[model samples]
Target: MMDQLLLALQGLRRSRVWLSIFRREQLPQTEADWLAMNRRNFFVHILPAKIHKGSTRLSYNWIWMGVISTWLFVILTITGLFLMFYFVPSVERAYDSIKEIMNSVTLGRFMRNMHRWAANLMVFAVFLHMMRVFWTGSYQKPREFNWVIGVLLFVVTVLFAFSGYIVPWDQLGYYAAKIASNIADGVPYIGPQVKQILLGGTDLQQPSLLRWYVIHVFFLPLVIVLLIGIHFWRIRKDDYSKPVEYERGRRD
Candidate 1:
């Protein structure tokens, strides 16, 4: 029985059906073949087959803020999803649910801590990434629109953190959200209406909780993911700005 099961698993691993679903149709047989396969495959195709050595230099990129930001986002997503298993998005039960997670659920406190810290780190990471881009003149000419998209992404990242802040229904989150909503209300023209829409009325309560939960978990994730895809797609198309030496060498 064990031998039959092992054989079955091995057969499935090499089967065309399994390969089609999990991997590219073409199997790479050599170093050259692997590089070509990346361009041909749907998933890996978006990534550049080759990157400039100067562009990837640690001195030029300095800890790769953009990549770190992306990793932090991934961490936040995983930790947040795990946290949701124990979280209730209602005002009455929300704080208590958090308490239960910290006290009762195995590894729940760790996940919550990871989510909190990742969200905080992402904000700084993204800001630093933008600064690095600006410092490197990566936003010049052809990359201007990409910079705009990055700014929008930064905004969306902040909104995601803010929206998630109230999920615990703690006094800190509650008052902070109220202050933010009031600040929104002070904006020109649609300020009052925007505040009304956000709070769902005059104050932050059940409606606000539901709205924030939906925005935090669903809408903002969709927007950020779409924008991130576009950002990377453009990188593949334009390629990131090269080091100053490369630019000078090309010009010469």
Candidate 2:
């Protein structure tokens, strides 16, 4: 039975339809084949053809926080879109729209909660991932540029959270925006201009809400996605950083 199953699966993999989708009849079995396969496949091309064993260890990587962060971002994007269908960005209606979503829309509360928590967790996970890289000396030499990119990504992630935090326009969100704009207003030379750009005025109001909504839903997502693509490409180019090892009495 097992033999028959294996033969049938092999035949199916070689079928014209499968070949059309996968663009290959069989898995790569040699170095040249692997290189050709990675080059020919878009998804595979983004990933390393080979990875260091140390890079895969849980102890060294600390729970794969980078992957977790990426998955959480995905979750937030999906749930945020679902919530957007019911959310109104208008200051007057924003809070009520949130209420309606919670009380009336199907699974709305669940998705909103998922989005909220995922946003929070993404922030946490990204921070931990950065720390892990720093401690593991993964930011050295050829990876310095990627480290800078990662820092930019972390900043943008924080901005993503902060912008989304103000969308509901409730008292909590309103005060949060007020505080943030005030901080922006304290920048050394461009304080007022910065605040103006952020709030669209001197105070938090309709325009502020609308601007943040656009930023949270559109601008930030675009920036983060671009940054992530670059970061991944850099990883593939530079190769994964192997964890440092120490002997009891000697250092290599």
Candidate number achieving the greatest TM-score relative to the actual structure: 2
lDDT of 2 by residue, 92-137 (tens): 8999999999999999989999999999999999999999999988
TM-score of each: 0.86, 0.87
All-Cα superposition RMSD per candidate: 3.2, 3.8
Global lDDT scores for all candidate models: 0.86, 0.89
Q: Model 2, 59: alpha-carbon shift in Å?
A: 1.2
10 residues in a row with least lDDT, candidate 2: 243-252
Number of clashes recorded per candidate: 0, 0
Q: How much RMSD separates candidate 1 from the native structure?
A: 3.2
Q: What TM-score does model 2 achieve against the real structure?
A: 0.87
